[model samples]
Structures are given as C-alpha cells and as structure tokens.
Target: MNPQFEELQKRMNHIGNLNNYLEDLLAKIPGNLLSGKQQAKLMDVLLDDSDLTSLLEGLKDPRPPRFVLVGRTGVGKSSLINAMSGRYLAEVSDVEIGTEEARRFTYESDGQVYFEVIDTRDIGESEAFTKDADAEAELAAVVKAFRPDAILFLQKATERAHSDIDVESAKKMMLSAGYGLPMVGIITHVDELNPSRIKDPADYPPGKLALMEDKKGQLRRIFKEQKVPVDAIIPVSSYIEWSQDPDDLSEVERGELTIGFDGRYGIEELLDFLEQSIDIRAAIHLGMTIRIHKISERIALRFIKVFSTLAATVALSPIIATDIAVLLSLQTVLLMIIAYLSGRDLAFKTARELLVSLGGIGATGFTLRMIAQQGSKFANLILPGAGSAISASIASGGTYAIGKAAVAYYLKGVPEEELNKVVKNARDEFDRGLE
Candidate 1:
C-alpha cells in the first residue's frame, strides 16, 4: 500500500463505526419529497456493515471504478491507464498470452492501488478462438467475476483496422453488462492525427481539431447505426511523458490538470464522465483518487455537501429540535468522516471536542436556526408556502455553517478565532443566496 492511504487506514482504525444512530436519525427525519420506499432504500444502504468496511478497504488498496475495457488488443490500453494514473502503472508488452481470460489488471503505485479494469481478451483475432472458444459464454463468466462500473470501447485515432469486428464484439459484451449500462466510445492517440508536429493538445491546431471531431463523429455514427447504446463519445490522447523523478516536477506540472507532455488531453474530461456515469456509491471512492494527501480534502468537501443537503431536504416543516438533532447527527457523522479523510483520528470524541472548541451558541448554528424556525412558525400562520421555503433556507444555511466551519478547522486548519467568522459568513452567504 502507498504510505499515504495506508496511513489513512491506520487513522481510520482508531474510529468506531456506529451507524445505528445515523440510521435512527434518518428514520425519524420527516422526508418532504422522499417516499417510504426511498427512505427504506437509504436505510438498507447504512444497515450493511460489510459494505462500509469494504469502502475503506477500497481506498487503502485503491481498487475501485472497476471498468471493463471493450476493444481488441492495442489501442493504447496500457497507456490510457498509465496516463490516467500519472504513473507507469501498465507496461506495454509486445508478447500476447494467446488466452481469453478477461483478466483484471490492477494499477498500483507505491503499493496503493488506484483502480482496476477487466482487460478483455481480443475476439476474432484468432479464427480458431472465435469459432470454437464460446466467447459469449466466456464474457458472461467475466461479468460475474468483475462487475464493471463503466464500459469503454476503444479505437485508435489514426487506424481503423478491424473496426467492424471491435464494434460487433462490443455489442456481444453488452449482454454481460446488461442493458442500460453506460458505454463510452473512446478515440485514442489523437496526438497521432494530422499535423503530428502538434504534440500538446492545448495547442492543437485547427487541422488536429477537425480530424478529432471527424473521428468522434464517425464513432458516434457507427454506434448509432449498429443500434448499440453509447452514452458519450470522447476523443483523447492519453500519452504523458513524465520525468523519472516524480518530485522533480515543476509547479505547473504538479497541478492536477497539467501533465508533463503537452499532447495529453481529454483524459480529465473522460474521468469526469466516468464519475458522473458510474454508480453514486462508486463515485464516492473517487475522493481518494489521484494525489493521496489532497484526496482527503476532496472527500471532506464532498462530505460537507452531502450531509448539508441531506439535512436540509429531510428536515420537517415544523423545524423542531428533532430536526436539529437529525442535522446534528448527520453533521457529526460528516465530521467523523472528514476527520478520517484528513488522516486524523476518526472518532465521535474528536468531532465533539472540535465542536466544543467552536463554542456553543447552540453549537454555533443551532440557536440561530431555532430562532429562524420560530419566526417561520409564525409566518406559517399567515402564508405556509413562504414559511416552508424559509424553513428550508434556514435549515440548509445552519447545517452548511457547521460543516464549513469544521472543514476550515479540520481540512484547512484555520485558527480557532477564525472558525466563528467562517460559520457566520457561510451561513449568511448561503441564506442570502436562497433569498
């Protein structure tokens, strides 16, 4: 395991998982929009203890975003993964195993894994394998072995050899994935397009852009003609020439979007597409992706958003202390997760102590939220439509305040004196936006 995320797991070990309180709070919260079925679905997610442990294990080992690569041999599969990883995770090998196992290729650096993919065996390459191997049944077995979060059909930006065979094979694989699965068409090696001198994608000339658009259009047209479902068509150049020494990288190169080679483009966009198209629970693992230390901050930022939104949306119109307790419990869990993400001890005591440090003007937000709730109650006597909106506004703002304050403290390490200002500013800013 990478020293960074391995350390994260060590820190997480200190925290206890008490999902019961969260489940109870969620069950009690009045859902204005959620039906009984949705509530039950949410509870079922929390009830499974093993899933929670597996999530943390995924971060530590870095095995998630299980993608199924659907294409013939070559098309820069190794380079695509390596480019996405910003490391030499996959070695391009010339020798073929002559096997059709659909093996899982795991990419790990410094012992921490980032992701895994089902590298499917090339079909129709050998007439003997295609005619006699029962490729369809093999693919079904693959589906059981490695359930993919996304499926990608790959083609070289410069070559079109066996495109028909690749597309047909992709259609057959869809049976294994089941219908409605997100399938993306990838046009790789865009740097090899016309005007090969244009290496950096940032400086892609008009000729290169036209060629890329042309390829994307062709891919899209083919998929449509075949009646094969594809969610997105992306043309990407996944080649990145990194320095042998990672620490020797420049400031610009160190940035997430910037790569060592100029021709690298469309990868970040593809990753964004995967995050959006993948399962919501799977997407959560994305927080720990890329830079290990900063992964925590990303996770913490998302936590604040998720907890605040859940608290606000589920809050009852009456906005009683029960509503506050719901918010508090969710916020507390949010803090615990945030703390764990920051590589600190993940415990209720840690959150409680930090919260105590924030001072209790009803824990810096509750009292103000209650005051607003009381006013909204009176407003309900007159115009309930306006009062309901006001209640939502206040609940959202209050929880957001607590969350932001904790983020500043835990993630940004903002000083104690500054936390109150953050709380007040966040609450005021959110409330104003709602207004």
Candidate 2:
C-alpha cells in the first residue's frame, strides 16, 4: 500500500474509534436523565460529516427569529420584553393605550441581531376594535409583513374579570393572517395578585402559588374555549421590585434605598418554554439575540453534569491511553454543546483546534503526567484493591472546569488570551478538588 494511503487509513480508524467511544458514552447515561431522542440529536450534531463552515454559516444566518406580541393595552407587553431581554428594549407606559402603529424592536448583541419583536397595538382592547373590519385588515397586513415564528398573548394576572375581546382578537389574527405559529399565553403582573406584595416569587405562600396556578388554568381554559391552540400559559412577574441607583445616592446612604431588590421571577421558566417550543435553529437565534445569562447558565450546567458522568464512567478502568482519549472526546463534545447553548457558532474545526490547544488526545509526556497526577490523587478514595477512583474525581473536576471556561468564552465573550487564563484557573481548581 502507498504510504499516504496507509496514513489516511490510520486517520480514518482514529476517527472511527472516537465516534464509537462517544456513542457508548452517550448510551451509558440514563435515558430519563437525557432522553434517547435528545441523545440521538446530540450525536447527530456532534458526529455530522457536513461542511463545518457551511453548518456554522447556516446557524448564524442573518435572519432574526421573530415573535409577535398580541395583547390588550395595559397588559405589560413592553415590560415582558424588557424582562426577557434583560434590557429596556420596549417602552413601558402607564397610559392605557400603547403605540398605535405596529412597532418592531430588534435586539442586538455584539453587533449581531438575534431577535425581532413585533408589538401589535390596537388589538383586543375594545369590542369596537375587534368588530372594525379596518382594524382587522390592518392587523392582517402587519402579521403578513412580520412573519412571526411564535405568538405571545399577554394578559394581566390581577384582573379577575374576563372578557371575550382577547379571544376574538386572537382568532382574527390567526385566521386573517393564516399564521400557524405556536401561541403562548403570558399572564403578567403576577406579583400584583398578592395582597402583601411579596418580593421573592419563590417565597410566595402556598395559597399564592395555588392562585397563580388557578390563574394559568383560567387563561388556558379561555383559550381552549375559543378553540385557539396555545402551547403553554406561563405566569410571570415582569417587575416585582425595583431599587434606586446606588451611585445616585450619597456614599453613606448608597445602599439604603436599594436594600431588598429581588429581580424578576418566572422569566427564566418562560424563556425556557419558549426555547423548547421552537426548533433548535430558532432557539439558537433567540438565545444569541437575548442576553439571558440565567437560562444559559442553567443549560450549560445540565450539559456539564451529563458529560461529567460519561467521563467518569470511561475513567473507571484507568487505561492511560483509552482514558485520556475518552476524556478528551467527552470534553470536546461538551464544549461544542456549551457553545451551541450559549448561542455561539462553533465549527467542528474550531472545537478540534481548541482541544489541540488544551492537550491533544494522542498521549504526550505532559498529558501523561497530568493524568497520572489526577489519578494518583483519587486512588486512595477507592476501596482496597479496587480500580482507581481518582479518575472519577478528575473527570468531574475537569468537566466542571471546562463548563465554566466555556461559559466565559461563549456567553461572556472573554478574549482568547483571557479565556486561556480562565481555563487554567478552572483546571487548577479541579486538581485541588475545589470545583
């Protein structure tokens, strides 16, 4: 055989080995923990043979994910946007009527547009508006142009009295525009329902929680009664508490005015539901456009746990060559998933480059020393004559470090130089068992 052909065959074997290892690792994880369907999807994404650049380009397509906000006036549509985006993108007003013309709000981060929010005004507030053919026609025109991927129907939670105007308006919008998009019912002003006005949403009394559930049920029932299909009805308090700027106050009294400001609650749940309801492409677009660190952190942590378990399983037997290979593969796949969750476009080549920079899978002297040191540290933890438990500890610690580093790199946009430092710090922490 030609030398070049032999080398090519060797590389193919290596690739095949890695792919099989990853599949086995994924299978070891419980299906309930990571559903088989989700596992399969992740495998497909990680092992795809498609052009990496083309895949990334498609992920980063300029077309923003669009959402249409449909609600009556004074329902806190603007506030909802502000809470979800963590920016005052929409104008909150005390006036009963919102902007007359349909307005588009684009959310951009680091010069890249992520989402387009369309606020449809003058709908569902009055019976006359719903009855007016002209108003209906105008709404149809707006919906046609916006081409929204989802519909968010906002309703004030405190309002006990119900009306058919909202239902009628939704029917008209869905019918005239022929939008088959998923509809989500958002019950805003949930905090207002509590007479005592609790600042912490999680601290709500059992009765309060029950009331919230009941309200959500009511909203769902109303939509069902109107024959309008809704994906979910989430209750959220856009702004339960606010604090004054510390800088604006005197130095001595700076913290006085802002003593107990608990941020918005239920927003994360709403965002999660929205992300899951849409396809992966739209979810990625939304995540990139919206700066929701909490949601991203939650997802990244979950992936870290999943991958860490897989890594530990591979390390249990402690074959230097196989252990390092499996660990590296797990970490590489982990970083890729973290990047995706963070709404960052990471090509396969970039992931491979990162792995090489950290430490290539082919065992070098440096890599061997590091693995031995990690294994030695936890060797005592295993029972007498048992295989080294050091692998398990190192696996968990390294995975935790990788997760933190990935979060900083992809979500926080840390520079490459600084990101390396972050990775180093994480590794040190893991070695010390502090992670």
Candidate 3:
C-alpha cells in the first residue's frame, strides 16, 4: 500500500475505534440495553422489513458471487475481471479446484469479499483432455457442489472459434445447478472489430455496431439451439488503459495506453443487466458490491429504515432513561452507518462537530418538539403502555431525522449549516405524520 493510503487507513481505524468507544460508553451510562432478547428483536425487525430483507441476507452470506466464466482460451475473461475490479488481479482459473486461488479475481472492500469471478479453465480450444475429466464435465461437477450466481459466456466478436462448446458447457453447468441459471453472452474484444481506429464502444460507427449485433445474434442462436437460457448478450472491451499502477500519476502519464480501450465501455450495462435479471439475493449483493448508481440510494434507504426500526424497538424498554440513552447511542451509530453507506469517508470529528452544532450531542439542547418528546418519558410510570408507545415514537422520529440529515450531508452535499434545517424539516414531517 502507498504510504498516504496506509496513513488514511490508520486514521480511519482510529476514528472508528473512537466511535466504537463512544457507543460502548453510551450503552453503559444508563445500563446494558443490548440484551440477547433485544438483539433478537432487532434482527426480527430487520428481517421483517421488505426493503432490508435481502440486504441483511446478502450481508450475512460472506461468500461472494461465484460467476462461472465459460469460454475458450483468449476470450478476454481475465482482462474483463481486471476491468471490473479496476486493478490487476490475475488470470482466470477453474474456480472449482482449490489450485491457483491467487489467480482468481475477487472483488473485495475493506477486507470483505463482495464478488468473485470463477473463470473456468480455458475450454473448447479444440477439444481438450484435462486432469480427472473433460472441461465441461469438470465444470458440471463443480456447479453441482456449489452453484454459481450466474454464468458469463465470453466470446470475441472478431474471432469466435468453437462457439458450440461454449453453449454446451453452459448447458451442462445449468443442469448441474439443478435450477436453470441465468447466462450472459459477452462479446469481448469489440475494439478490434470496428474500423479499428475507433475503440470506444459508445462511439462505434454503424459498421462496428452492426458487426456486434451479428455476433450477438450468432451467439444467441447457438444458445437457443442448444436449449440454454440466456438473459442478455452484451459487447464489451476489457482492455485496461494503464499498464502501470494508476496511483503513480507520473508513471501513468508516461506509460498509459490511451486508445479505444482507454476507458472500459459496456461494463456498466452488463452489470445493470445482471442486477436487474438475477435473483433478489444476488442482485442486492451485486448492487452493494459495485455500488451501482442506479440502486445505491435504495440500498442506503434500506439501511436507514433498519437503524430506525432498531431504534424504535430498542426504546421499548420500560426504563425511560435507559430508552433515551439507547436512542442517543443508536442515532449516533445511524449517522455513522449512513455516512458510510453514502460512500463518504467522513471524519468522525467533523460529524461530531456538526452534531454538536445541531444540539445533537451538546449543551445547545433539544428543540421544542424534542423537549416535549422527552417530557413524555415521565408518562412511563403513570401511563405504562402508552408511555412506551410515545417513547418508541420519539426514538424512531429522532433516529429518522438524524438518518435523513446524515444522508443529506454525505450524499446530497447539503451544507452543514443547512443540515439542521433538514433535520428540523424531517422532524416536523414525522410529527405531522403522527395521528
């Protein structure tokens, strides 16, 4: 790692540790609120909410997507994985076997694996006899053991050799998965198919576009003939522009290969197709992994809802002071999570400063509505059940306000001074929402 990046990572860890310490202190000031039963309640609420159901399911499944890449040698699968990851990972491998694990590309973030490209051994070069069994048979056996999220059928538009075997292998893998698996036909090396001079797929002239269409048609017909189901066939150029580490701007400035493949094209379209076509679980994983612009806001909203619900249930405890303390702690954590999900590398101190200014964790104190909300806590002794309902409502509203304000700050670029107004507005809305 570069020194600068390593330093940034260290700072981030330190801030996270501080926030964790703060949360721990808050949890203890009033008492232990996160009992086993309360934790179960949070989980139940998260699972019950439809928006967060799939996200929670995906987060727990540590195993990344197994994308079975089926194609002959030189089909550009290795380059495609690098393009997707935006780095030099390695060559493709037969993902079934444990050998050559380093060569397999897995999309990871902060040490958590998000997605993996299980590139099958280059198959159908002419008919290959490999160790243990034929290429297709081995792939079938692997799929039988662990089903892939989807299959990527790769072929070069300019040179598609032994296309029949590509279709056959996908067929066998689909059968092995028991349930039919969605397959995407990828036409690689599209930059070479054109008038050659123009490399960007978006800028491809009618000639190149028509040629890609013909290739798609050919692959589609082959898969259809073999009775294999295919979701979409896309044309892409997987050539990475930089041969050197991109961080070294000087090296990249001198050694960059700026051409048709300078900026990879059609990858976004392919990912969008996968996110829209795959099962809910895989789609959530892909959306989170790539941070797809199309669905990122939805994912963020899911987390917001999760934290808000957690705040509500955790506030249901009979002790009013405990409920309030827990809500404050939960709201702080909610802000941290919202900032993170918004893809912002925020300094915890910056957030703390903003919260203090808004009277979130400072002597500036609560707004009128908040004072009333807090005043309702006294009802817990007199009203009991009704007081609990009011407490839960207050906690939920406060959490939602903090969550929306954090989203505005991190995602919408709302100015810090203006965030208080956003929080005020959200709180007002929640107040109005109460019957």
Candidate 4:
C-alpha cells in the first residue's frame, strides 16, 4: 500500500477508537425525567406555570444543525465534505464508499454559525428483507437526534438523472426520515463531458440539450410528485478540476473556480446557494454529526462481527463433536443463501461465500480423512486418511479471510463500481505502458 494511504488507515483507526470510547460513555447517561403521571407532579412543584413551561421547553429544545448527505453509493459526498471543510477529515477514494454510518464533521466559524455534515451509507441498497425497515429506522434515528434543516440529495450527472435507482431510493428515504423537510438536489460529475465540443449547457447540440432538459424535468417532477420541496439543484464536479493549477491564471483572472471536469461553472452556482440558503450554524452542526456518526458506525460494525464470531464459536463447539457434519453443512448452506441474496453488497456476499466454501470443503475432507484412519473400513469408504484435520483447518481459514475483508470494507467504505473501475483503469494503463 502507498505510505500516505497506510497513514490514513492508521488515523481512521485512531479516530474510530476515540469515538467508540465516547459512545460507551454516552450510553451510560440516564433517560429523560418526564414520565407518565410524574409530569403533572413535577409541574405542580414548579415555581409558576410560565417558569415550568420555560424549563420544559429548554429541556426539550432540539439539538444542533446536521446536513445529511444522501445519494447513491459512489457519489462525491465525501469529496464535497472534504472540499467544504478545507481538510481531509473524511476518507476519499475512487474505489471506496467512505461514509458507512451517519457521521458528523463540524465546521465552526467565529460566533454561533456552525455546520455539521452527516454522512450515511446507501441505505436504499440494503437487503430486500431489511431495506424498508432499516431505512425507516435509520430515518427515524436521524430525525429524532438532529432535525436537519435541509438534506442534500446527490446523484451523478453523467449517469441518468431520472430512472436512476439511487435517486428514487433517496427521495423515498428522505420522506420517510423527515416528512416535508426542505431539500436540495446536487448532481455530481457534470465536468465529465468533452469540453472542446461543448463547454456549457447552451453550447450542447440541440438533441443532447433536449435530452438533458427532459431528464431535469423528470427529476423535478419526481420530487414534486413525492412532495419533497426542492430548494435549488446544483451540479458539481470536485476531482475533475484536480489537474488544474490556479496560480497560472491569465490576465482576465476568470470569474469561475475550476476544479476540473468543467465543474466550476455549475458548482460555483451551487456553492452560492449553499452559502445563502443554509444557516452556517446548521451546516457546522451537521458536519460534527457526520464525523461522530462515521466513528460510531465503524466501531459498532466491528463489534458486531467480533460478537457474532464468539457466539458462533461457542454455539458450534458442543455440537461439532456429536454432529459436525450436520452443523457444518447447515452453516455452509446458510452462508451461500445469504451470499446469493446480497446482490449489490459484494463485500458481504463474497465473505459469506468464502465461509460457505471453506466449511464445505473442510468438513468433507475431515470426514474422509477420519474414515481413512479406520484402516480397512476407511479405505472401503474412500477417505483422504490423515488429511482430514488439515483440510478442516484450511477450510476454517475462509471464515477468517472473509471476516477480515468485511471489516476492511466497512472501515474504508469501498464500493463495488469504484473497485471495478480502478481495476479496469489499471489494466488499461499497464497495457499502454507495455506498448
């Protein structure tokens, strides 16, 4: 691995550790005091009705501002956060989905104005059996903890504007989480078009322009249909302008800030709206929530794996001796079934398959080897003799491999499309260099 990447990984680990400690401490805090009939009793003991009302209102006051970054898996949510904060607090990569949980990254400026960026995973892509429930629960949690002033629904402009599965999923999720909440649409990757042919929307060929308008219209209608009040639609491209150097500007000193991919034109407009519409305090609060959520989700996911492994080990121990074959077979079958069901979640699915394959081969070999050890009877049964234990051990190693991969996947927020693209690009680059 690159040294910089390795350093980043280490830092992320440290941050996660700190967040876990905080969560543990917070969990210990007591619940609210107002309960059932006690509410009336407390009110009676208050100095006066006005004073009691003020106290209750103060206690029930809403938390800080949190901006939820909702969109498809590989959209530039993390990149945008990094750019806005002017730092590398959130991890960024072409191959990874960095925000696995609802994390907060806060931006505090001067007095009371604050912005908190909240990052959440692609809840829409959750398992079919759990997607609705999971999404609903996730929405409820977000709404309850921090009543976000606005949600930034993101999508790739290069990708279809309408009929995009992620866009649809996002609209549904937002409504479920915060009914009638104000929202803004952000289209990413607009800088990807060929600049020489057509630099702006006006310059595009009539046919393509028409198509673009239709898409925008469709998207607008969808949101309107869903009753999600749209504030402003901003198209942005962050990394497309990475290749440019601002120091070499001409005498004209362009009005636009080019980030690459011709995104400066569109994103500048969006930034203007963000500055004007979103309260700075709310943005900072959302950013903090995003940072916190990232830390908690990562720690919680790791804990889940550790707990599950320990439970599986203990649960399987007693049955292994008496019914190793049956138990092993069942475990393998369950994993395979789960792997098949997890269509888009490649990391999880792959891990499940690895476990299934390992258990299957291990148990088969162990049984055969044991039977082989029985001399004539084993030979008659056609077993691998002393190789049974070795095979079983090797097979069990699959569990470890998958577990490690899953942990890394969640920690890094790597996505399937980005992984494939990187691999493909590397292959093409290698071929070119060889030539």
Indicate which candidate wins on TM-score. 1
TM-score of each: 0.69, 0.53, 0.56, 0.38
- Give the poorly placed runs of model 1, Cα more than 4 Å off: 12-16, 20-62, 90-104, 109-114, 124-133, 161-164, 242-263, 279-289, 317-322, 325-336, 344-370, 379-390, 401-409, 412-435
Kindly list the per-residue Cα lDDT of model 1 for residues 1-435, writing each as its tens digit.
556655654544333233544453354445653456555544443344354444444433444677778776778887787777666653222233233646667665544556767777556455654566566576676665567787888999888777777777777677676655788899999998988877887788997899999998888878887888889999888867664444675433433233456457898788778765776445545545554555556545555665566655545445443344444555666666676556564455567566555544663456655566646766666765566566666666666777788788878889978987887888788778765
Least lDDT summed over 10 consecutive residues: which range in candidate 2?
90-99
Model 2 / residue 11 / CA error / Å = 25
Model 2 per-residue lDDT tens digits across residues 309-421 = 56666556544444554456567777876675555545555775765555424553225545664556454455532444665666666666667778887767887666556
**For candidate 4, which ten residues in a row score worst on lDDT?**
336-345
Each model's lDDT comes to 0.65, 0.61, 0.63, 0.43
Off by over 4 Å in 2: 1-58, 62-64, 90-101, 107-115, 160-162, 240-260, 279-281, 289-435
Residue 280 in model 3: shift from native, Å? 8.7
Q: For residues 129-195, write the lDDT of model 3, one tens digit per residue.
A: 3343655465556565666778888888887567777688667667767776788999998888858
Q: Which whole-number lDDT from 0 to 100 does residue 405 have in model 1?
A: 86
lDDT, candidate 4, 1-435, per-residue tens: 235323433433332342342233223222241232332322232223342233223222313455777776777876665354433332312222232444555543222223555655545555451355654565557544565666788776666633345556556546655455557787665545444345554455656445445546766777777666678776555543433444565322321333444323355455445533544333223323333333323333333333223323322222123223322332332233222222222333344344433322342332342232222222323543333333333223322333333333344454633433333343244336436
Question: Judged by lDDT against the true structure, how good is candidate 4?
Answer: 0.43
Instruction: Please provide the root mean square deviation of candidate 1 (C-alpha atoms, Å).
Output: 8.0
